[model samples]
Target: MTATTSPRVGDEIGPLEVRATTLEDLVRWAGAIDDYSPIHFDPAAARDRGLPGVVVNGPWKAALLSRLLTDWLGESGTVTGLRCEYRRPDVVGGTVRARGVVSAVTRDGAYECVACEVWIEDGAGERTVVGTATLRTRRPETGGAPPADGHGRAALIGDRLRDALRVGAEAGRFTYRVEAGDLARFVHAVGGRPPAETVGTHVPPEAPPTYYAVLDPVERRELQLEELLDELPFAKTGGGNAFNEVEYERPIRVGDVLTVVTTYEEPYERDGRAGRLLFRVRRNDVFDADGHLVARSRMGHVLAYDLDRVAGR
Candidate 1:
């Protein structure tokens, strides 16, 4: 059924147990996503590149966190929002666990819950990925029924597209140290070395590729949905609602500091069968240590109440 069906916060949602982090696991993760860097495989290369051992991809940890939440909430639950900060590299052979605790519930006639924090911890109790999320469940008696207020459908649609109205810039700078293990894990996950004098070298002898998945300066990633919701005026008009569609621009390498800057470029409104729909567009720029542009990404959010219905029954 659904997480809301349970109706309690402290209840144990689920647990992710960890075993030895293997090279094969790393390779499979990166290859599946088409990321290939040498540090994951060659020990000598890793040594030359100045890492203790192999490192794991930061996004993999984020994915694990996402899985933990979805599995705990049940198949019916949808991930409304997710924001992760990469603190430190998870090395090969290190054990980690993903855990969650119910933090708060927002009941506006119907119940919607927010998990304040979900984290991934290493064997020594060190956190790798720190983040938060939100989930919505249908009211029990009216499963699949229309909302009590006809405006619900229109509201959901409006919120999803409200991002287009935002205007201004948000910027932050983060620094992180690169270790050999971090590079190796990233290599295994994405596949291939960072282009080196010798094949099979775990670390690259020279600078790594722009697509390498390096640790950013911030130890804990922040998912500021509250701030984002506050910044956009449309979000306030119809009961703040939005949805995310994320895409990776490139891989981040180890020991590289990244400066992330974001801006609200445009906002637009459209009319649909349900009612009025709003759309918001935002852009993110990622820069390397030398202040050079590494990658750019654009994200759009759809604001509306009839999200499920719009998808088609």
Candidate 2:
């Protein structure tokens, strides 16, 4: 836990015990995040929707992954990148644990970094979320070092990203009218720490942390917008999600209508242990009614359709 613990390959992160989540917990999270989906709050509504019960929010599990890495690295380390795949939905009122194992340690520029394979498990011990994380920590006595001219390497990455861009090309834009009901559903979905001296009745000021999931423009009309993916020449019928990241500038409010713009970024191929893998990156920008930028997301998808084709080429 110190600044120089020097995490090695195969080091354990935790069985960080988190208690069973309850209805009140869900409600509180809903209020805190502004996610009030009835499936997370109204059992009848969930049943009507053919769900097992009120479903736990996917982002809640993602946040738990972040907490696991942060707790393991301590104050001295900084989490540089995190990638998560929501494999399965954890039901409400279930006890879940966050766990991880160090996978590798290497140097990047001035920072020594540790990479971990992390997961969250339900009471039944089934993994609900699986992902990888990268944290920058103090250098170890010996390890793989980054190449010289770190700044040049950074510029190279920027160049690669630029090479992937389609000049003046933009994905179709979509809009979401923020509603009070939507806010309630989102808040209830991400149950978090409740406020002290709980009051029975009041309105919250901001939307839940992951409410941007609702603002995703691609879901509006799948087939029409999916043409964007075709631009990348994916091998299979559809590619699987590799990772997703969201950074927010400010909280979205109840009445702020959001306009979302999607742009396809560069697609790059890298050689992997399995074979050659292609990664496609997309960017989503969210702006409020007044045109103020509010949130940004970068989504990465791994294309495996023509795995054999990319391999050894």
Candidate 3:
């Protein structure tokens, strides 16, 4: 379990109770974070996109997987890394269960550590989100200039979208200070108990695992992806979060001001069940006010475009 009790390989974390997420729950989450699309709460909007119905938030699912790890570690440890992919969508009104099994356990200096393979499953017992998490006893605290300016990058879209996505293509940097009120609302939306504030002091017992999303905002960065696709070369189609991998230098305490520098990297095309898929990858590096690397996040998105248009139909 931690530095106290040995967590051996193959030890299980949970089969957290299969719980159905309600529309209100999704609203609470949407209000707390950036994922507020009609596809999350409107059935017709989902049907227009070929989904069976309204779907649960992918980041929310990632948070649930993180909870599985923290719930197992108790207060003795914190998750240092987590990576998850939404293999399949989970529709609203359906049940989701989380479980993890320790795959490796070792010692990192003074902290004991373990890695677990975790996933969320649907009622049919099929995995909807699958990933791995790394946990260690909390450790003490652990970027660079913004990439070359991006104003000239817009001319590089479409035929040269690949060029625009070349490694190190700067997407711009953003800054935010962690607020206890924001953290509390996010924790409650995910059904976690938030730490209480005393007088004017407010430090969470631990930062919520997936709160890093608030800092990244990868797809919506300087590129302003939506303003693209104005031409007939490719028509916009279905696209949203594809996956996310985050590594923390330390659990972010309240009031830490962070600036994240984002850049495009490893853009490529692959074939999915529908047809050709375009994947755009971004890396966000977060630094504290003192310029210490607080966290780094790499996020993948299924860029919206019609499959037929991509096929030259």
Candidate 4:
């Protein structure tokens, strides 16, 4: 779809109501992501933990928000960044509608991007997840104004940023078997609500695109997904997920042992109205047990901290 055809500010997506009928859906997700927190599948276990009924996975809800944006953006657009905070849980057998509304649109280089306010509402209209997203639609040959270069603000930590970019030169890798429990935990973790009657020998549900982020934290921690900023020698004030985009070559199913290798591109500096922005782009290559590509995830993080303390007297 062309830019004109895509959703613009104030557009609403849907009342896409979804439900989880039995434990099968939750169990399936548990197996997919290898998380058996029990709180997800076992009602007794959940109450034992001092919770209500089965608590939907936070990751699942976040993914649903992504789904809402992607569906609205259509085939020509991409949901570049999705940031959400889990406010509550949608218990088992509960139904909710995924919804989105375009909040703003701005031109980023050659891309006309859409920013949106997204959320999930229960059958009774209570919000369980809330956040904002940034999506990009393809632009015609006629591009917008050239990207800004810091709005003329002094590049305060210019020298410090240069030295910090090279802190981590090596990428990290991890491997794991895609068990049933893994997927189930991952599914609910991201608030996956498969069809109520979806059961059978048909291929099990695939984990959410962002599910891989939690697979193997032990080995991944050393490389710290957020370490790029810590590597910088500056007093960091604020920074977070600018956006995340995942492309799946094929579905990941149960019993498929997978290997993931994470690598980062050089930290590039951009001048934004806020300050000198350094974006760290991290890419992950996921391969099935046979080494065939399963999916790829690109996460963009920004470093735009106040430098007054360090730059000032």
Model 1 regions more than 4 Å off = 1-13, 108-111, 140-313
Query: Which is superior by lDDT, 2 or 3?
Result: 3
Off by over 4 Å in 3: 1-159, 162-167, 192-205, 219-226, 230-232, 235-237, 304-313
The predicted structure with the larger lDDT, 3 or 4, is 3
Query: Which candidate has the highest lDDT of all?
Result: 3
RMSD of each: 18.4, 23.4, 22.4, 23.9
What is candidate 3's lDDT per residue for 1-313, written digit by digit as tens?
A: 4334567888888888547888977877777674558999999999999999999999988988887787776666789999999999999889999989989888888776878899999988999999998888643222122247656334335546645454666667788888877676666557643333333444365688788877775543544543443443665566778998899999886888998888888677777754457777888889999999999988887755664564255
Model 3, residue 168: what's the lDDT? Answer: 66
lDDT of 4 by residue, 1-313 (tens): 2334545678886646676534776776666565668899889999998887987777777767777766555555688898888888888788867888889888877778888888888878899988888888876433234246763222323444433333245367788788776576456445554533334424346765566665533223545544334544455556667777788887767777888777676677777766767787777778887789988877678877555555222
**Model 2, span 216-305: residue lDDT tens:** 664334313233334333344334677878999898888888888888776777765544566767788999889999999886777554
Give the candidate order by descending lDDT. 3, 2, 4, 1
Q: List TM-scores for all candidates, in order.
A: 0.42, 0.44, 0.45, 0.44
Q: Residue 282 error for model 3, in Å?
A: 0.3
The superposed Cα distance between candidate 2 and the true structure at residue 3, in angstroms, equals 3.5
Query: Distance (Å) between predicted and true CA of 11, model 1?
Result: 4.6
TM-score of predicted model 4? 0.44
- lDDT values of the candidates? 0.57, 0.71, 0.75, 0.68
Q: Would you give me the overall lDDT of model 2?
A: 0.71
